[model samples]
Structures are given as C-alpha cells and as structure tokens.
Target chain A: MRRNSPLVPYLFVLPLICLLAFVFGLSLIRLVEFSFKQVRGIDGPWIGLRNYELVLGQPLFWESVIHNLKLFLTIPVMVMVALVLALLLYERLPGWRIHRTILFLPYILAIPIIAVVMKEMFQFSGPVNAVLTALSLDFMVLDWIGSADVALWTVMGLIVWRETALGVILFLSRLMALDESLIEAARLDGASWRQRAWHVLIPQMRGVIEFFVVISAITMLSAVFAYVYVIGGGRGGPGTATMVIELYIFNALIRTSLPGIAAAVSVLLFAVSLLLIWALFRVRRREEA
Target chain B: MTTTARRSPTGAGMMDRRRLLQAGAGLGALTLTGGLAGRALAQTPTLDMWWWGEQELPGLQAYLDKAIAAFTEAQVTPMLQDTAVVISQFQTAAAAGEPPDLQYLWNGIYHMESVWLGYLAHLDGLMDDGLLAASNHGPLSRFDGHVWRMGWYPLPMPWYYNKDLFDKAGLNADAPPATWDELLAACEALKTAGVEPFGGGVQDGYWAEWYITHGLSQNLDSVGDAVNLFIGDLDFREPRYHQHWVKLQELRDAGFLNKDMASLGLYPGIDLCVNGQLGICSSIGTRLPADAKTTNGRIGCMVLPVFGQGALAGRPVVDMQGMGIAAGSEAKEAAASFLNFLNQPAQLASFWEATGWIPAASGFDDSVITDASVKDLWTRWGKGDPITNITNLMPGQFYEQAAIPTGQNIITAGMSGEEAGELAARVAQEWRDFNPDLVEKYQQWASELSAG
Candidate 1:
C-alpha cells in the first residue's frame, strides 16, 4: 500500500462531499419537491406539473429570460475592456501603478454605496446633466436611468463599473506571469507590438481569457438581482423593463406567494448556470484535446 | 460473570464499544438539556411585535415599553422592524405556518387574503370573551361577520402644506382645498407664480397619490363600503379611474409637477418643500417635522382632498396605517390581551403622544389629543374622517388585482380610466375564476355577521 495511494484522493474529496450533501444537495432536493407541491395559505399538498405550467405560461418569465440573455451578451464587452486596460497598464507606462490602484478602488466600495453614487451621478439635476448644460450639449441630456428604454443599460453600466476593476486586476496578474522571452525572440525577427501581442501574447493568454469569461458570465447572470432591487428603484420599472430572473423569483415569492412558481424559476436559473458552466468545460476540454 | 465468560470475542468487543457510545450520547443530551433548561426557566412568554418606524422611534419605543409594562409586567418583548423587511418576513412566516403574535399589517384587501386563505386566525372568540372591544373595529378589519385583526393605531394619510408659501401666494392657509375646483385653482395660482404645485418626484411611486385621491373621490358615494370591489367582480373602465389618469398625464405634459420627477425620489422632494421651492406637498401624518424643518415650521396637516359627490363628497379621503395580531400565534391569549391593552383609550393616547400617530381606538377625550403636534390630527379626525385609501379597506383579492394594478396602470399609461374599469371588471372575474369558492364563502361570512 503506497502512502500516496488512490484512497488519498477519496480522503481529499471527503470534506467537499460532506459540504455539498449538507448544503447544496439538501436545498436542491427541497427546491424540486417544492416546485411540484401545492400551497394554500400555509399548507402544502402534492400538485404535479401545475406549478411549472403556471411559471412557463406567464409572460413575465419569458421577458426575464430574454433580459438575462441580453445581459449575457454584454459580459464579453465588459471583460474585453478590462483586459485591454490591464494590458495597456502592464506595458510599464508612467504611473501604471497609480492607474492600477485607481481602477481597483471601485471594487472595494459597498454595493449600496455604489448604487447611491450611481443614482446621484445619473439623476436629472446630477453632475452629469450640469456638465452637459455647461458644455451646451443639452440635447444629449435626458433622464439617464429613469427612462424605460435605458434603465436596464444603466444598471449594466453600473455592474461593469463595479466589476471591471476586479477583472483588470486578474488580467494584470496573468500578464505579469507571462514569459517575456517569447516576445523578445519574436521581436528579433522584427515583429511589431501588435504582431507580438496577437501571435505570441494572445495565444498564451487564451487560458486566462477563458477563465475570466466563465467567471464574468456567472457574475453577470447573478448581478441582475442587485441591479433591479438596489438601482432599478424596486418595482422592476419603468414599466417592468428592468425585471430579470432574480426579481422574477423575488416577485413570485413576495408578491404572489407562489412558492411553486419561485421554485420553478430557481430551477430554470440553475439550468442556465449549469449550461454556462458546461460550455466553459467543453471549450477547455476541446482546447486541451 | 458467567455470561461474560460464555460470550464470544465478537460479542465482548461490540458490548464495550456500545457502552462507550451510550456514555458519549448521554453526555451530549445532558449538555443540550442543561443549556436549554436554564433558558426555558428564564423564558417570560415574550411576544415578538414588528412595525415600521423612523430613525428616531426611541420615543415610541419607550412609550411602548411603558404600556407593555403596565399590561404584562415584563411578559412581552416587542421587536421593531423596518417596512422593507416586514413583508418578506411575514411572507416567509406565512409559508412556514408560524408568524409573530402581533404585527403591523397593511390594512388592505390584498393583505386580508391571508386571513381568508386561513393563514390568519379569526378573533371571533377573542371579541366575545371581551378581550377585544367590538366598537373599535374598523371596517377593513371586519370580515364577513367576524373581525380578523385589530387596528390599534391609525396612520392618517393626509396632505402637508407650507403655510408661509400659501401666505406669499395670497391663499388662505387655514382653509385648504375642500373641493376639486378649489384644489385646481390653488395649484393653478401657484403654477402661474412659478411655484411647483405638487412637491414630489413622479418617479418613486409618488404618482400613486394622484390616483389614490381620485379613487377616494369616486368611492364617496359608498363611503361605508370603501374599496369594496377593488378585487370584486367590477369593471376597471370606469370614469373615476380615467379622470385621475388623464389629469395626471396633463400635469406631466404641462410642467406643473416636477419634470425630473421620475429621476428624483422622496428626500429630494422633501428638500424642495422644506426650502419653500414648493407651495404644497401631498404627504401624510404629523411626522414630517422629524424629516425636515420647513419655512412654515414643519408640516401643516389637513385631510386629503376628495372629489365627485355624496358621502365622500365633503370629507377628505383618510388613507391610514394600523396594526394587527398574527393569526396562528401559539400565544393567542397573551397576544390578544396585549392588543386589547394597547388599544385602550389611555394606552392608545400614550402611544400617539409618543409615536406622533393617532389612536385607532374610537373614544378619546380632548386630553388625549393635547399635544400641539397631534392637535391638528385630533381636530380633523374628530367628526369621523372618511376612511379613504379605500384600497386599504378592500378585500385581499380585489386590492392586489384591481386596486394596486389599476393604480400602477394609471401611472404606466397601460390603461385609461374606462379601460381600467373594464380591466378591474376582468380582474374581478379572474379572482372568481382562480378562487371559485370565495364568493360563497364571503356570502356565508356576511350572513354570519350579527354586529357591525
């Protein structure tokens, strides 16, 4: 029997298994059970696919799904911005450290504080409007976060502002770890900066890029709740335009008292997260193979 | 000794291990029991009470403590909660078959659906036992023939105006708008003078008041049955709803209300009113002084303006807030007793003196309303102010589908008053569809009612 035997792997996994069983596994079981149950006032009875039917039949659920999908598309843009900013700073430009710190500061602000600041900055009489009026750009001024057309996008902007800093720091660390020898070698053949970054640096940073993409996707999906509740001013309004999956679940649970509906929404959210995770794994596996 | 000698080796090993496990189990049980016993003995049958209060609710808390001490002498514990957390907690508790003994429930038909759905326990026996006074029961709290919740305190949702602004505008501050025509003229006068007529942001659900006032006026004819069909089998396409919606839209178009109302919230509105930038602000209660110091020395409280004709004709819509006991409380007697004690004229008066709200209790003397701040409230509510905010007095199903939805619709431009009336009618039909048994149940409850 070797000291570093196959059994050691099992021992290493025991803590994780115990944690999953007690927490996630147990909750998932209850969630499934609840999704199929009937609740009257406080009492519950078994009621097959009735809850799922109600949930899927509602127009609001479809709207939430579409909204979250739109959020998914915006994540890539945010991540790319972060990566480019990090790479620029990593070129050892003047005051790069200071730049890094400034970019990273917003990541530390509390969510509620971020929400309050965002509200103030975007309000009709806020600083942005004042600046616009001063510059004679009054045509560009409108109720930035209050309009139904732009409320969702405003929340996305705030999320990007809050999250891009962390992404920048992550990319910066990855950039620092990159081997400089390949770049120098490639430069000996008269390779330009763009050529080197595209051929050598880009290929090398692909793994880190994939990692950030997966993480950012997950963050963007969950960010819907904080956006709607904190910044969207709590009705998921201007006309339910800002409503998303999390708010849908919350509305069902609080406003409708339909646990079955809430449970179905939870399952759908889980499936969404799982699909994203699987896609990430598939990409990684394909790359490795 | 003989058995040990005869036992197999496996048996002996198992016996020893089992004894050791038993000893460990005993130790664990003793620890839990020992810890719990002390706490159980010290337990003074406390009741958790939740309510909404401002930042400086310490005065109210102290007064509550005095009242509680007088009643149970340290038998109850009142747990204060903010408004945002109350609904979520109550929802969770309702789902779990447990809730606080006494809670400050919103007096709406939507809220009463919980009682109808059996999430709440009826206080029929409690009332019969003389623990709850039949006279103090508000129409909203009365269900079928029985009462479900007690309204211990009444939150008067009224208008807060600036006296100094009115004086500058050449309008009498004492006699505020008693009719729709007067209110419009006042607003027009202030508007011409470049003063903002309505002192609130249109964004932050402030537009509800515009529709609420309209609903109040419409229900003036059926004052006793205010908000009755909010979720009933009624049509939403009524003129009453349209009148309010069209008027609000016109205000939005004309720039009489704040143009950036959608972007600004309550604090900014309050700030504007305080600085005399606004002539009149539609707000409720005697609590405005605590938030901001206005040019007129805090808020001037008056009844909400009513429109239309008949019983609600002369009176202002009295939108209010109040408290109720939980239905499934294990400590029903204690909770009932506490609510009873709290509703007594003396205790109710004390609560108002401390909390700046009026007692919902029916009979109170001039001494109870002696405080300068509360005097305005006493004078207004003296001759039984019309309980407006009819939504608060509606049945649960109707309030959610009809009242709240219609209110939201009027603001969203989703439906006009006629459409809203039609929509309300549709909603009532939907309620009957979803809960096919409710109508008969309500009828039975109505027939069972021997007392008003």
Candidate 2:
C-alpha cells in the first residue's frame, strides 16, 4: 500500500466500474444486436435486414428526423434564456429568494402533471379560451395543438415552458458558486453590463453551461413522450404534425410491436442524441479556448 | 497540529462504529428472512390476483373472502391476494416471463394478438370442467366457437340524462329522444333553461365514445356494425360522418356543452352532471352512486338516439366488456377455479349489485332488473337490443389501425370526418397487408373448431 499506488483507488472503485461496464456496455451491445438482426415473435423465423429496410425506407422516419431537429434547436435557446434569468435572480435584489423559488417551482412538478395542467390551460374550452371569448377575441382561440399548422410549435412552447425552469435551477446554483469579485473587478475597469456578462461571467461558467446544455438536450429529446401521449393522444396526430422521433419509436412499439423496427428507431435516436452532445461539447471547448 | 492529530483518532473511531452498525443491520435482515422461510413453507397456499376496479373493490374483497372460506371448508386451502395495477403492468410481465395467476384483460384485438403470441394459455380444459358448467355463465365466455375467458358483468354503453333538468326545461318525460333531430331539440330546450345540454368529457377521449355510440350506430346497417370496420366498407367521404361532424360543430357553436368541456376529463365532467350543472352524456349502463342521481331520484339512461335509421332508430346498441386470463400464469388451476366461482349465479348477482353491471348470465331473478330506477331508463335498450361497437366487428387490430387514430384526428380536426373514414379504410388495408397469413390461419382454426 504505497502512497502513490493506483491499485488502491482502482480497487475502491471496482464495483462502480463493473456496474457501468455491465449495464451501459451490455445495453449498447443489445441495442446494436437488435438493430442488425431480425426480431421474431416468441418463436423465431429470422429474416435479416428486412425489418430495417421496411423502417428506414418509410417517409415517416424522415419526417420524424426533421421533427427531432426542431427539438434539438430548443436546447440552446432554453440554456440562454435560463442563464439570463438566473443572472438577474443572482443580482441579490429585494425578494430575490422568493423570485428564484417561484421560477424554480415548475421544476419540482412531475412531467405528466405538468402536461395535464398545460393541456387544461390551453384547451379550447379552458381559461385561455374563456378569456378570449369574454374579450370577444374568439379567432385567437383556435386549436393550439389540434391544428396541423401550429401543432409542433404548440408542443415546443409547452416543452420550453415545462423545461426552462430546470435550466434556471441548474444555472442559479452555478451562479451562486461564482465569485462576485470578478464582476466587481470588470465593473471597476468601466466595462458595460453586456461586456461583464460576455467576458467575465460566461467565460468562467463555460464548463457548467456545457454540462447543462448536453443534459438538457438529451432530456428534451426523450421526454417528449409525456406531451405526445397526453396532448397528442398517443398517435402524434393532427396529420402527424406533432410526430417527433420519440413518438415514432413509440408508434413502432405500440402500433407495430416490431421490436426490430422499434430498436432501429432507438438506434437512430441514440445517434442523434450523441451528435447533439458532441456538437454542444465542441462549441463549449471552442468558447473555453 | 497536536489538537488536529488527537481529533483524527476520534473521527476514525466514529467511522468504524458506523461500519459495524451497518454490518449488524445486514446480519439481522438475513437472520429474519432465514427464520421466516421455515414458517412460510408450512403455511396455507396463497394465490395472487390483480384487476382494475372502482369503489366496489371493497365489495369484491368481501365476496371473495366468503367464497374462498367456503372453498377452504371444502378442502381447497388456497387464499387469495388481490391488487389493482394499470394495464402496462401486463405488458411488462409478458416481456419478463412472470405474471399474476389471473388478470382482467380488456378483451379486444390486443387480447387476440397476445393469444397469437402465445402469451395466453388455451382455456379449453377449464371450460370443459363440470364445475365451470355448474357455476359460470356469460356471453363473453362463449366467443367465436370457444370459451376464451369467463366474465361476470354486462357493462353495456348507454346514454345518461338528467331528468330534473328535462322536467324544468318542460320536455316530455314520456317521450325521450329516439333520433338525432329529437336529441338536438332536447339539448336546445335544456340550454334555454340555463343548463349545459351535454357534459363533454373531451379530454378523457369522450369524442371516441360519441362516434362509437351515435355515429356508428346510425350507420350500422351501411357499415355492418364492427365487422365492416375490419373489412374497410364504411365510407366517411359519404354523407354519414359529414352530417355527424356538422351536428357536433352545431352543438359547439350553440353552447350545448359546458364552456370548458374540451378541457374537462371524464371524472370531472361526470362530477358536473352529478352536481346538476349538466344535463346529458353517453356512458355505460351501470348504476351511478346515490349522489350522482338526478333530482327525480335517478339518472336516465337510454340507447343512443337514431339519426338516419328512421323508425328502427330508438333501439339500443349494446356495448360489451369482459375479462381475459393473461396468456401466462403458473397457477392455471387456481385462476380457473376463481373464474368459475365468479360466474356462479348468486356470485354474479352480487357482483352486478357491487358494480351495477347488467346480468351477462341468463336466468337471474327479474327483481335484479325491475327494482332499479336506472333500469326504467333502459326500457328501450332492454326491449329492442342491438349489440356491438363499431370496432368490435373489425379484426382485433381495428384498435391500432382505425379506432385510435381516426378518433384522435376527428376530434383534433387534423382530418375531416370524411377523411378520417378514408384513412381508416386505408389503415384496414395495412392490417390486411401485415396479417394476411395469420388471418387465414385464424379463420381456418375457427372453422375447424366449429365443425368439431
């Protein structure tokens, strides 16, 4: 047990290493296997690549790819908006704690419950429409999610509303840990507020922001299920306007029950998630440099 | 430096004590489990059951307790443990190769698919047993040419209306709506009386029920009930669905439903009706709780009003619901016995009272039907009974292809009613494309079983 012996620390972390290798590594292997092979019923009559060909050739898969791109765009906007909000809250103004607490409240709400609440508030006969009706603005009371034209945007709005709070909470804690002296020093040098934010604060918060952007993007992609299921009513309908990649994967599971096709969709989704993470990481690296 | 060195020894001692305590807890847990195994091995046989139920779940427990005790006295020592988890649990169990002995499966194309996938055991032997013959009876038990699963209740879909609201509106109580025109008139009248004419459960997939009961029933002869849905014979581009859509839009425009109905769910919408704020809605023909009855002492239930069918329109279309034993169960004997017991006439009657289900079994006492005020509401339904839902006649995959997507589209206005019908026909085509061989196999199996 020499002081510099690497084996001591390696032995201490052996259980966690085994856990990651078996769980994540084996899951990746199975996903790849299912993507390549033919999925039979309880019994096998394997016909390789046929299921993949069937899925990849469909127009809907491409449609879903476009939908996923829209979802991917939300991550940067969400992070930026949340960072701005957190910076304001961190200014230590009157009732700053109350303001921060209020903004962070929605993060504590379960996704399904939030989805339900949002649906009620936005539905045709709900308070939103009631307000429109009372003010004689009935045209504005058009189907928020029911029309093909605005369905995707409506869903994006809901996701942004539901998820921006998570970003706020993350950045708030990160901002609190940030040194105030840096901002003070920049201000003493006659730097404008924008200069201080861009040069001083953002530069220091680079790693934390990158971490947040990647995790939030991943969550945004996978967590579309709640909106798709509750608001879209499980079909991602209104002419498949709200049909995102996760929904397409769900359709393959429920509508077709073809695990091969479903797994293929999962593989596509997995690739997209990795690409998004890589892109954000590259951006953060460049910023840091 | 001397004080810090002294404190390190105390900190190390505290850490050691905590580790020892954790080890002691682990040892105690292991000892308790080892001790309990011997006692558990010697105890009475315990079988677990799972199903979704309403407030009547307590009544079911009481009934089961009595029946199981009688069985125990007759030398069957099995005890039952029950739970109510959602349907997703069944799918998970199917994937994992372990499931409860009995489960109440929503019988549809999904059940048929599960059967084909060999997720269900063939229950022919259970049906053939003398005990089952003596005890169990119901329409759902006999399907195609075989006994698939046993059921005790008849949860037929019916239209419910508030009688007090109708009386206040000065509508004739003796002549309830039998056609679309009359139903509209009644709604119009109720609206004038400052009542919401219809309690729309729009958020709870209420629009699905409306299409199935009213729209499909009006076009039943043209579509041939649920069967034509499978075969793609119904044309929404035809005037049938267009007319219904227009009627729904008219209702919405005229404020026949509550202001926020599209946002309201089933339970909340039903609560509104129960609280006397709304007048009418379509629901199952089961009894409502005491608080849910209208001012006339009962909520009125009727067959869906006729639209295009003319004089034969007032007849009720019976919607059926039943249970299926999951494809995988280790305790097949135990589950089958429970099913048989539930189907017994006395037991079935008790279940009917608890659940407000109509008798699926024949030869129940007339008092069961006659004594209830809600029964009076179902007079037309009882006499001119037409049974089936639009999706029922279709192949079991009708749920996936037609029912789910078409309903969602129509309500959302993603597609017009006519376009939805056309899309449904196309979906039916896909079902044929996918399951051609399986369909042939099922048909052949059915024919062979019928001949035998």
Candidate 3:
C-alpha cells in the first residue's frame, strides 16, 4: 500500500487544529480581555488593573486559596491507600475481583449524586452522627458539615473517598502489566511483602505515581466546584470555610454579577494551575535523571 | 395629427402599448399579493413569553395557557424554565436584542437591575386600566415614576407560630407575641419546654435578608428610608442597623435558633418547623396554610414584633411577584393586550383560586379565599401597612457578598454583631465605589422618591 503524502496528513488534522483554536484560544483571549474591564450588564468598558486590585484585596479570595491548599493534604493518604489496595489485589486474594469492582464503582459515579449523598450522611443529626451516638461514641458525634473548623476537612474526606478509586484503577492496571517472574524471584529470595513493595513494585510504578499526583493536584486546584457547591450549600459556607477558587469565581459571576473580578480570579487560578503542573514536571524530570 | 398618431399601426406605437400592458399586469399582481401577506402577518402575531417558579406556584402554567387561549389576536409561546436558569437566559436574550415579549420578575433586585440596564419596557400608558389598586403595588411596580412591571401579588413575610407549641409552653395560643420583649419571653418559655423557639436557615443566605428586613421595618419610617439605607445614604454602621444585629445576637445567645441552622437549608428548616421541633417560624403568607396543613397544627400569623417605637410598627416586609415586558420585543401591543386580559376580574379571581395568593388586581372576588389562615392574611394585607423587602430594594452584591456572608460569619465564626455590621458597611461602600454609575442612578431615584 502506498503511504499518504505529508500534505495530506496536515490537511487531515487542519480541522482539529482549527477547532482547538476557535474554542480554547478564543475563549482564553476573551477571558483575558474581560479581566481588564468593568462588565455591568451585557457590555463591558475598559478599566485597567482595577479588577485585579479588587480581587487581591478581598480577604475571601485569600481564604479560598488557603482552603485549596488544605485540600491538597489528602493526596498522600489517597495515593497510599490506593497503592496498598492494588497490591493486595495483585496477590490474587480471595474475592479480589469483587473488591476491585467495588473500589472502582465510586470513580464512575456522578459528582453531584455523590456530593448530595455525602451531604445528607454527614449532617449534624444525620445517620453518621446517629450511629455514633447509638454506638455510645457520643464524644465523636460532630456537626460535620456545619462547623467552620470541621467543614473543610469533611469536604476533603469526601474528595478522598470519591477520588481514591481513580488511583486504585490506575495502579491496578499498571500492577497487572508487571512481570510475574520478578515477584516470584523476590519471594524465593526471602523478601517480605513490604520489602518487595518498597524495592520492586514501588520502583516499577513511579511513573504512574507521578502522573496520578499531577492529575490529583489539578483536580483539587480547579475541578472541585460541584463538591464544594453542593456540600457547602452553594455558598461555600459555614462562613466561607469550604470556599475554593472555583466557588469564588461562581459567586462573583452569577451571584454578584461582577464578571470583571471573576475573570481576574479565574486568570489567577489558571496561573496557579500552570505553576503546579510546571513544578510537578520539574520534580519528575529530576527523578528520571 | 393626434388622431392619426392614435389610430396608426406603426411598429413603435405597437411596442409601447405592449410594454405598458405588461407593466400594468405586473403591478396589479404584486399589490394583491402584498395585501394578503400583510393581513396574514397582522392576524397572527407571534409573542414569546418566558417564566419560572411554576413548581413552587402550581397551576401557573395552566393559568398562562388559559390566558394565551383567551387572547385571540396573538399566538403566545410560553417557555417555562427552572428558577436557576431563567436569569442567565434572560440576560443572554437581552444582550442579543431579541428578548421574549413577556418575562416573570420577582420584582426587587432582579427587576430593578433589568430596569436600570434598559432591558424592561415601561408600562405607563398600558397600566392605566384601573384594574389594580395604586396603593397595593405602587411601591414595587413603579420605579422612577413609571410602571416597569405588573405585580402578580404581594408576598408578605409574617411571623407564624404553632398554636399547639404556644399552648405547650403556657403561652396564649390565641394571641401571638406583639412586642420584642413579649417575643423574648415566649422564647424563654419555649426553651423551658425543651423546644426551639424560632426556625430558619442561615446557610441558605436569604434568611439574612429576612432578619434585616424585619428589623428595618420596625426601625425605619418609610420605604424611602429603607431604600436610602440600602443605597449607602444611611450606612449600615448606623446605630439603628447595628441594633438589628445585636438583636439577632441576643437570639443566638439565648439558644432560640435551631442547633443545625448553619447546616440546613430553607426547606429543612421548614421541615423542622412542621415537625414541631420549632415553636415559631417566619414564612411567606402564601405558604402559611400549606405549611400548617402539613404539620396538622393550627398556625397563626402576626407582624414581626416591634423592637422599639418606629413608623412601620406592625408592618410586614412584602415583595411582589410580577411580570415585565421586554424592551426589545416586537409584539408590544399584543403583549400589553394579553396582560390586560389576564388582569380581568374573572381571570384574576381564577388565578387567586388556583395559586391561593392575594391578587394584586382589585376586582378579584374575595370569596375565592377559602383557607381561614389565607383569609386572615388577606385581611391583614388589606390594612395596607406593608413595607417592601430589603432584598428587593438593595443591590444583589450587598445581599450576596456582604449581608449574607456577614450573617454566616456571625453564626459560624463567633463574630460580634458590631464587627459584622462594620464589615457589612465596608462591603457596601466597596460595592458603591466599584459601581459609581449605579450609585448615581440610585441617587437620582432617591431624589425623586423624596420629592414625592
């Protein structure tokens, strides 16, 4: 068979390139334009760096940033639990297939459905608290979604519960593709399970681990809107306790109709995401070298 | 010579006659077709209408359908949307200069914002049919001395007490609390009976508006004073406004509010009230009878207890649910005609029967109100001492960014009322600074309000 010409390949991909330019490129340009203007109703007028100043001056914005940073604390716990579960499944333990299916179920569930269920379960007088009280663990009963000190952590716990499935699926696929003979050799050499995990299995899965970390960070930074919105009752409150950058942007845009400030905050969030990705890549490059 | 030219069979004359005959035939056919098309277009004008809140106010869609059927001059297309999506949809339509001919407005921040943006058409000449009393909806329907929207009904937020709970606490079930001190004493009695005295959701944000509006009505003299306070003429730092927060703090400290208020939304709070967990709750008058029925409890409505002597004592904060014609609509006459038809005595009475809401129009038959609680509400509404809700009179930013959040902070973070009041004032000032144009427009409105 004859190969296609180089021009044909470029022509075939031209539509995709055009689509990306029109969708992503144009939106980014418009977003930047909107950030430097005062948008009232439909039209906006140019106003310079005033929107940025206003956004930065808001204490709520800083609080949201702090909340996003706190959510990142869940990454290590999620990764470790997922890796352990995947390793156990790799051992071919009884009911391993059923466990794997159960573990992956939450990943496929819709965010809004999960958020709503979790919000109900974690209410002050909800089933979780009722169970605690019934079990005579009265001291442990808490206002899970209401207290300012506890709401953010509760949201983070929910994120970890829903997101650990993704990590498990990724690690399990990588574990399945591993060489069986290597594990056998390690066992024959009298290496314990923990030692094998530390020396052989963990080293083999470094690339996947790095990829999961980056993706998790990105999700935490920009894609926790539904969780925060539903669980926080759409205001990211009990006094802005669960607020994140996305919620802040939504409140500014939809509730306050301050598109200029929302756009400014969005641009800042984009920068933060870029910085996070860059830092991850730099760390991965160092490890690879 | 003329006779010869006229009778001659020359080639040029023959050609001229043929061209003239062809032109005459073409012109006649064109005129006939144009006339038919114009008549067809005039007979069937298409008008687009968009509305929401049909779920909460059942039978709204049925009423609209009947209205459309009754109006024979135009074909009305009704687009029903969820409450969350309607505002954004209206904004997009307004931007495109092809807004629907008619839209439902909750007549406060939303209506005023649209009016200020020139998205709403003024109904000066159209609303002069004497169908609605000027005093009932005059404050809400008119902005800048022109009617920008036609009010559907006045929704009064009055204090509702469970008569059973009142009796259980040894308080009079027949007579509700009439003063701030009496309300507090009732709360104390309810607390002694191991019951929550008041139920509302601070998490939903609207409860903040309810509290502030209740306080303002008891503290301010007129709607203009409330509007002035909202527009930053009378700052939130004023002692009168600060006193409202102090009163709220006293309630919080007294353990009168529900423990899970910070976690619950409005519906959950309503559930708590209906379940007898709450002794008292503030609710819209339209929802009182239904809420009462759900609880199997006898409920009574009263004005929010006056904290101190003020001009608006015994008045409840009322907001109007209404309709506005879009500025960009092409079928203005047809839309106005539909509105007039819908406001007729029979149709308005039918609406009252279906929705169980007090009608804004005057000629509706009062016999349609069968529910005793609703009838009592109508009697109170007839007294004509209602004040506009602050949420309707203030900017959206003030409520969403400043007041709601500050109220939440007071509940969750243990902030002092003084601190919350100061922060709220700062936020309001910041909003004014950011939107100087809106401030100027508000000042113009204030001047007109004062002159009147």
| True C-alpha contacts between chains kept, each model in order | 0.24, 0.17, 0.46
Sorted on lDDT, best first, the list reads 3, 1, 2
Cα lDDT tens digits for candidate 3, B153-237: 6677777788888889999988888888999999999999988898667666667767777875676766666567757878778
Question: In model 3 chain A, which range of ten residues has the least summed lDDT?
Answer: A1-10
Taking all chains together, the TM-score of candidate 2 against the true structure is 0.78
Tens digits of per-residue lDDT for model 2 on B251-302?
6656675764544555566666666778887665554534334444646666
lDDT of 2 by residue, A172-267 (tens): 888778888888998999999788888988777777777877787787677678776677645565546667778777655554555566777788
B258-284, model 1: which lDDT tens digit per residue?
Answer: 555566665566566667777666654
Candidate 3 stretches greater than 4 Å from native: A1-8, B1-42, B132-136, B295-297, B450-452
DockQ of 3: 0.41
List pairs with backbone clashes in candidate 3.
none
Candidate 1 residue-wise lDDT at A93 = 93
Return whichever of 2 and 3 wins on DockQ: 3
**Overall lDDT per candidate, in order of appearance:** 0.64, 0.61, 0.79
Docking class of 2: incorrect
Candidate 3, residues A174-203: lDDT per residue as tens digits? 998999899889999999999999998999
Worst 10 residues of 2 chain B by lDDT: B73-82
